[model samples]
Target: MGHDKLLVLTDQVAVSLATIWEAIKVVRKEGFEKLDPLIITQASSDCLLFEEPSSTDDIICVCKSFEFPGDKLLANIYGVLKPGGTILVYLASEPPKGQTMQSPLERKLLLSGFLDVQTSESSQSLAIVGKKPSWNIGSSFSIKKSTPVLPKVNFDDDMDLIDEDSLLTEEDLKKPQLPLGDCEVDRTRKACKNCTCGRAEEEEKVLKLGLTVDQLDNPQSACGNCGLGDAFRCSTCPYKGLPTFKLGEKVTLTGSFLAADI
Candidate 1:
């Protein structure tokens, strides 16, 4: 470990800077003259801190105070760790307070090409440690196309017994329908996607409001009335029952609705 270089990935640098400072001191005391670590405080969706393969011997990821996708972060970390290098993730996990993530963290690390995955508990934090196998890292882990293996499910039911009536046909899909009511249903399921009794056009209207509908929706701006972007709303205005006005349409301001109460 002493021969390998060190790197740190964190969003809350203010909270973890002290720990990192001590780590650097330890590295320097161990006679590693090149103690300058690559510190990454931020990353983008399309780009991560490391653009190339693993060059560092160890990478420490501090995620106790922040929320992030575990698998994606592990994938990025695995890509930048040298073969046989170590990765240590420090996170908040207090099971007594009903918060526990050690199991999931260990599973993710193992699936992300890291070997010897283990977890330890401290006062208010959980430490996850894994090592990249010393084997050819490139052949074992292709960071560009790395994907976690999903657990396989075993069912005793017969496949032929499945019902198909609930499924929507091609013609039904071609026809427009209205949106569904406020139901806590997962739309990604086949059963939900096949629903057609509801108005499909209404759903299309709502979806189009947030998406591009021929220059009508702008993602960069917020609504003047609600101050929320279109992505979080179905309408630009919430005053129900009011007659909608179109651009260039005119109405007399002397209407009874605006008459002063005497």
Candidate 2:
């Protein structure tokens, strides 16, 4: 009835487009050649290239791989989409089953700005096919917060983002992982307040060369920036079985140097 539009984000040539274009080509090949498709191809890097969009109902969003910024892409689709329009996503490629479990991709869609989205059973395809109730950009989105939300960690002091369980303790090259527990105390869901801990008095966990407990602690409380909740650990905070000092134990502990931030 009216002109339709599509946005493809996949790097693969035709394999991805086969799903949409194939369907259209099939319909066209069958003598219904009246359809005219307006296809806009883009990479995940330039998600918001189309700054001026009048409608999303007839648009499609494709990504080489569905990911974080893709969530914002979906939101963009929601903004211009007519009621009941579809948002299609293609993967860069498949990863191991253990890796793709639950499709972290859906998070990208939700993060992008789309609402009421759902993932498919195959662990690859995701869709958000609905028009958000009409509202001004200001009314629809909040200025206090950012779209495509990210995990928040508020350490009183500057801390490393290395992944827990990593054997490497290199500070600059630490792998980032989800933030875990409080070094001094257990952290609430996202308690903004700081927890207090004292230095370790007994033997400490040595990383590479078996440093004595004395080497670890230099201040009030001491701890290796170990893994989250003692489960996974970071290189900086390794699992040396360092004894946490009791009320008034011996000497030595592992913790950070007290800085203004902490």
Candidate 3:
């Protein structure tokens, strides 16, 4: 069989050397050519720094009397592991007070993008297993673009089922006729409160033509309907609702017309 490389990570060098020795014996008994087991101390920050990336086929983390590996260490381990490689985290001692070993290690493994994470507990130690994915990092593949299929509709068939005459009632079919009258209360087009319908425009023009003392003394009508009473006055007549008078007669505006409504 082909030789395989293994990584043994631990805080204690004695434990890691023992594990490597056992692994070597097992590999030799199994008739392997060689078992190159590398030991990385957890206390050293650059433990995996000298190792080639994605070179190790398997990793055994011996966590005895030491805290579980953190994210950075786990990431370094993942970087060193070959694609489809497996990692076994063996906790030889119980985690610190009020803390768990398996779950947090599993979460950290998953966060580091390990796959098929699992945990098993024994009387002496807890073992967490995870595998690196078969695909290498930074590898890219094209995703086929898909066009959604829309249901077909026939407008001609749909139009034949609809009855145009049945859609309207007698009231809806009837055209409304505007009432014929000069300022009928019900027929009068009421302006909006903001006077957006141009109704106040005429009033504004009338106010702009300020009634000076001379103009008040000798009132003149542009449309000759200023003193013809409300009935005969134009819609915008300033003298509307006033009594009829001669063309040159002075017209007095009432208090109602002078004072604006609140």
Model 3: residue 98 alpha-carbon error in angstroms = 3.2
- Whole-model lDDT, model 2: 0.46
Compared with the true structure, model 1 gives a TM-score of: 0.43
Which ranges of candidate 1 are over 4 A from the true structure?
1-3, 21-34, 42-47, 65-69, 92-96, 137-262
Q: RMSD of each candidate?
A: 26.8, 28.4, 12.5
Candidates 2 and 3, the one with greater TM-score: 3
Worst 10 residues of 3 by lDDT: 182-191
Off by over 4 Å in 3: 16-36, 152-160, 179-262
| Top model number, lDDT | 3
Tell me the tens digit of each residue's lDDT in model 3 across 104-209.
Answer: 6788789989999988776656778889998888998899999999999757744667688999999998999876532232323433457554544544443555
Give the range of the ten consecutive residues with the poorest summed lDDT in model 1: 212-221
Over 47-106, each residue of candidate 1 has an lDDT whose tens digit, in order, gives 365446877778777664434335677777677777888887766445445656777767
* TM-score to native of every candidate shown: 0.43, 0.37, 0.59
Off by over 4 Å in 2: 13-17, 22-35, 66-85, 92-95, 122-131, 134-262
